[model samples]
Target: MPKQNSIAITGAGIAGLSLAIRLRQTGHSVQIFEARPREASGEGAFLTLAPNGINALRALGLAERVSSLGIPTTGIEILNAAGRRLALLDEREAQRQAGAASITLRRADLLEALRQTASAQGVDIRYDHALIDIERKADGVTLRFGNGESAHAHWLAGCDGVWSRTRRLALPASPEPLYTGLTGTGGFLDCPHVPSSGGVLRLMFGESAFFGYIKAQEGPVFWFDSFTLDEETAIGRPDPAALAARTRAQHAGDAAPVRDIAAAVTSVPRAYPVFDMGHLPRWFDDRVVLLGDAAHAVSPHAGQGASMAIEDAVVLAACLTAYGAPSRAFRAYETLRRDRVEHIVRISRRRGAKKQAKGPVALFLRDLLLPLLLPFDAKTTQAVQRYRADLDPLVLPAA
Candidate 1:
């Protein structure tokens, strides 16, 4: 009876796409609805897939295939405004401690990989179906899309991203994402003078902002910067040029690479306010359950958002298969994931606070204290990367 029910997923991003594949593998009829057009993804951002992220995708048999999307990343080199190295968080050590290498690639590339995998697996994904409303029934849910289409499913998984309409509709009391008062933007560049970064990613604590860059041997140098943003400035979601200018001004005197990259990147990537929603008491109601950023949006400071969602997909699918119903499975999933995800959210918030550090005293204290804390932070990250979303056995509740 459990496998007999139809499953519907909202959002065709990593979370929904992965979940759809998992649910299909579990013998569930799954359909995914994505509000945006198929081409509306990738957004000029790049990401690093940590070992744990690779491990999570491995559970879905996707690790090896997606490896083609990015280059291997060996370590993170942390530096100050003066280009003085603070610490190099060695990924080799992390790999020894965890079990996989990190991959650095464009956010678009990863999505394309997942999208291809999902499609190849015969997952039913419908694009341009933006969810507008959902009607909850005892046995299932009726979803209304902006395209004037309505569909019903025995179970609904809301894998919609940070601005999830499903969360708002399904759980009215869920708090809005809390703005961390930080806005970030980044771009890619190909400069002849800039050498290949190989497996190293550079992170700089600049005088007025935070910057990071990852180079793909002879390819483009992907860079990003985050700085403090007041409510007024962040409201309009500053244009790319303005963001670029601001970033250039902030990092002009930091380091040669930072300055060079800033000067070369003419595209002022959109500087959107970074927000995290970590106050939800529950992630589901009856047949409707939230997943990924829809449930708990984590700041990019942790770099675990995608991994966490991928883990959630695998675990939740197992729970559903084990418990044979939505309520119990969702509750178990929540019980298993809430603390971990919320903790990551808190960590990301704190890490982001460091990027917004202002004043000479604050910068001095941060630079002074970060080295002492680097080892511990690296250890914690390695441990986090080793986490496997293994599920214990579950029995259906008695009728």
Candidate 2:
């Protein structure tokens, strides 16, 4: 039988909001607390939604709305710095194989969609409320907020993100976020130059560096990621003009289009510090649990960070619904998610290695090996996309 419980979720990002909605539907009362107030500027950037993420959202009755807000990406093309096409992905085949088309949209748009859906479902969202500390006892957990307010719930799910307070409280010994030796700087622009019909993802690789761009609704959004020995943190502070100028000066010899895209953006692009967080020893203990970036944050090289978080939310909620208790449900969620998330981490590491490869010799080797390996890669992605679990069955707590 299902237990009567009220769950407190931290962070208003996709994972927290989705979890709140799913749990509420399963008869748990949920309250969400976000650091940023309702009118605050969101994490500015763009993201691509894999078929799996779309399907998960669809299952929650949000597919159509969110899909409507994005531009469908047809294919991906590898290019040299001169804008010459190198290796092109078989887009139609990829779509048919994955069972759904991929979509890309600004990160803010996706957040808004999630917020609307969660709000409509009656999930209580308290913006401008930051989580300060968490105390978990035998019976439940208590959350203290920055507003001098506190709340006690049967369980606390920390969806708070990389610098998670809840995660810090639960696992104090966990490694602090390590720089992956790469800086991600990106922004949108009004570049009407790039053809919309040829809306292909372009990746230009060089010595220990890579540049990528895709057509966005507002314009052409582009990013430059460089693997450098000089490590610097790129989070929080946004001065788009300076980031754009710095990147342009750094990658001048590489490619003109990439340089142009970087030069075009007037706004300070969101700078992302490349951090790959390894799996924790336990995703949950007692009445507290962690979700999304709070638990696992993969490098953006794999392009599945956001997708994985959304998938985690859905999976976690399903586990709780099936297991009917916090401890059992958290165990099930960790078991199901660990392997998949770890697989992505390893795959992303491999991709990062490829990105670090130097010059033409490395490019030739990559070209030779990637095609032979592409089919297997595609197949693994297919498995992740088709994943589904029945929450009802997992809800059966011990007799």
Best by lDDT: 1
lDDT of 2 by residue, 97-151 (tens): 6566678788899988888878888899998788888776666877888999988
- Off by more than 4 A, model 2: 1-3, 206-208, 216-229, 233-239, 359-376, 388-399
- Pairs in steric clash, model 1: 240-268
Residue 306 Cα positional deviation in candidate 2, in Å, after optimal superposition: 1.6
Distance from true location, Cα of 368 in model 1, Å = 1.0
lDDT digits (tens) for residues 1-399 of candidate 1: 223469899998889988887887778888899998878855658888877778778777888877777878898899999999988877787676666788877888788888777787788889899999988776678899999998888978999899999999999899888888988887688876878777898999988888999887678888888888897788787776777778779889998888888888776757767889968988998889999999999889988888888888988988888788789999988877787788788878888988878888998898899999988887767767777553232322110
How well does candidate 2 score on lDDT at residue 323?
Answer: 74
What are the RMSDs of all candidates, in order? 3.4, 4.0
